[model samples]
Target: MKRSYFSAPYAVWMVVFTIFPIVFVGLYAITTRRADGNDLYTGLANIGNIFGNEGTYMKVLWRSLSLALQCTAICLLLGYPCAYFLASKDFAKHKTLYVLILLPMWMNFLLRTYASMGLLERNGVINSIVTALGFKRLELIGTQGAVLYGMVYNYLPFMILPIHTVLKKMDQRVIEAAQDLGANPVRVFYKVTLPLSIPGIISGITMVFMPSVTTFAISGLLGSGNFMLIGDVIETQFMSANNWNFGSALSLFMTVLILISIGLLNRMDKSKTGNGGGKW
Candidate 1:
């Protein structure tokens, strides 16, 4: 029972920050404010505008999803291998490497993105090097690729760390048992290691994908305003357009969509665990 006391702060935090904000946003989503700043019940009129003849919000939504999916996929591909290498017994400095991976995250996120922008900017370090070597400077910023790069760089560590944690905590005896059963290295990995790591993979996907989907700062900095995602649009509505009702509605929609995604991922993880993955 004493152990339960440790959770009190977390519970308070959830109520104050998460639950209250969500409820407040939901209230605003279903209502419109009048000229005198009094809220009037609108019954989804703001949501209706999302699917109205303009259809611009739909495009922004698609763009956000597409880039987020791409970022998630890229992070998975890159992080799994890095995680595997770090988790391997063959790497004597795995713990040191893990610390290095976490080091950059200690810095402010906006500052890190600003650093990336510097690296990718025209006449920046990368271009300067290429020009010195007699190669033409590449257009790195103000493009979809730059936005994707920012997402991948910032979120890749989130993917790698979870997978590494699970891999490091995995049961070595299960792997040895697979090998004793005459399984090859690759076969043992596929049959034992990979299945056990499903939980971490799912966790990594959730962490990376969710942030990538709702990011505005990274896209704004890297894309140089050329790309406008749903997050950017929502920011515009609230901060610039002063349309709290529509912004709240969009936020609510994104929240629902993200919840659905988490649900689906959870179901998939459960199914995988039932099939072959051992609980860690």
Candidate 2:
């Protein structure tokens, strides 16, 4: 009874902070408002508008998914080696190196996005360097590549930390055994280290992918509002258009999409574990 009483506060807090907002948004999504500022109960009207309007929302969603996947792939490709080096080596000042990796995350996200803009613009340092080297000036800002670069830069730490954690926890004897059995370093990594680090890969992928899909600040700051990612769409609908119903509907759709993707990934992970005969 005492424990139950103690847990009540947390349960009430969850209801107030989490569940209530969801319920409120859902209710708002299904209501209609007149020009006179009176809201009327209009079931499914907002949802219909979202799907029936030439699928603009869906296109934005797909763009967000594509950007997120690209960012995750880049992070994995770049972070794997860095994480492996950090985890496998006994370098001087190793802790300092890890701290440096984490330092970017300590800064404000908006500031980081703006900083990326400063470095990628027409008169930016990158352009100046390219011109100095006698290469044509590249349009780094307001391009898909710029958006992707921002996403990767912002989320790389998330990818690295998870992979590093797994690598650090790995048993060194496993590698030694493979080497003792005449296995090359590459072969040993593929057969032993790579297989053992699936959890970290999964963790990193989820960590980077989820946030990248929902990010608006980077796209706004770096992409110069030219890229219409789903997060930006949601912001526009709610804040700019003042269409709470449509915004709520889009938000709900995005939330559902993310939940479904997470569910599918978890199922795939379970299937892989079952087939591989390995436990996470």
Candidate 3:
């Protein structure tokens, strides 16, 4: 009973910060005001505008999803091997390496991203190196590639850390038992390690994908305002266009989309494990 009391403050915080905002946004999204200044609920009108014949929102959504997926994929491909090495017994003596890996995260994320801008800009560090090496200077900033690069750079640690935690906590006995059964490294990994690591991979994917999808800073700074993402649109709607109702509508839609994606990922994880996932 005392433990229940401990949760009261947290519950109150969630109600105030989370639930209230969602409820307010929903109210704004579904209701319209008449000439008499009375609000009327209009079902799906805002949604239809988002997905109707205009197709502008649809394109923005697709672009966001595509970039998010690409960033997630890149993170996974890079993070897995790095995590594997860090989690290996051979490197157990070097705990400092893990701290070094995490050192970048201690710095402000925006500052780190902004620092990358300096390195990537034309005639910056990279371009200067290329020029000195008798190579053509490459245009690095204000391109889709630059935006994608920023996403990968900023979010890669999110992918690595979770998987590293999971891997470090994994039971070594299972791995040894698999080895005792004469299973080769490749076979054991595919048959056991990889399957067992699905939870971490799912966590990593969620961490990387969500922010990548909704990020405005990376795209705005690196993309030079050429690309328009759903986040950018939402910001513009509220800030520039003064369309609070539409912005609320967009936020509600994005919340739904994110929930759906998380639901699907959870379902997939559950199907693989047959019980959501086993406790560590």
Global lDDT of each model? 0.91, 0.87, 0.87
How does model 3 fare in lDDT?
0.87
Candidate 2, residue 165: the lDDT equals 89
Where does candidate 1 stray beyond 4 Å? 1-7, 275-280
Residue pairs with backbone atoms closer than 3 Å in model 2 (clashes): none
lDDT of 1 by residue, 154-264 (tens): 999999988988898887899999999999999998988888999999999999999999999888999999899989999999999999899999999999999999999
Q: For model 3, give the 10-residue run with minimal summed lDDT.
A: 271-280
lDDT of 2: 0.87
lDDT, residue 18, candidate 2:
96
lDDT for each residue of candidate 2 in 49-83, tens digit (9 for 90 to 100): 87767888778888899999999999999998998
Backbone clash tally (model 1):
0
Candidate rank order under lDDT? 1, 3, 2
Clashes of each: 0, 0, 0
Pairs clashing in candidate 3?
none
Candidate 3 per-residue lDDT over residues 1-280, each given as its tens digit? 3678888999999999999998999988887756787778887787677886579889989999999999999999999888888898888654787788779899998898888889988968999999999999999889999999999998998998888877877889999999999999999999988888888888899999999999897888888888888999999988998666778898899988999999999888888967533322
In model 2, the worst 10-residue window by lDDT is 271-280
User: Which residue pairs clash within candidate 1?
Assistant: none
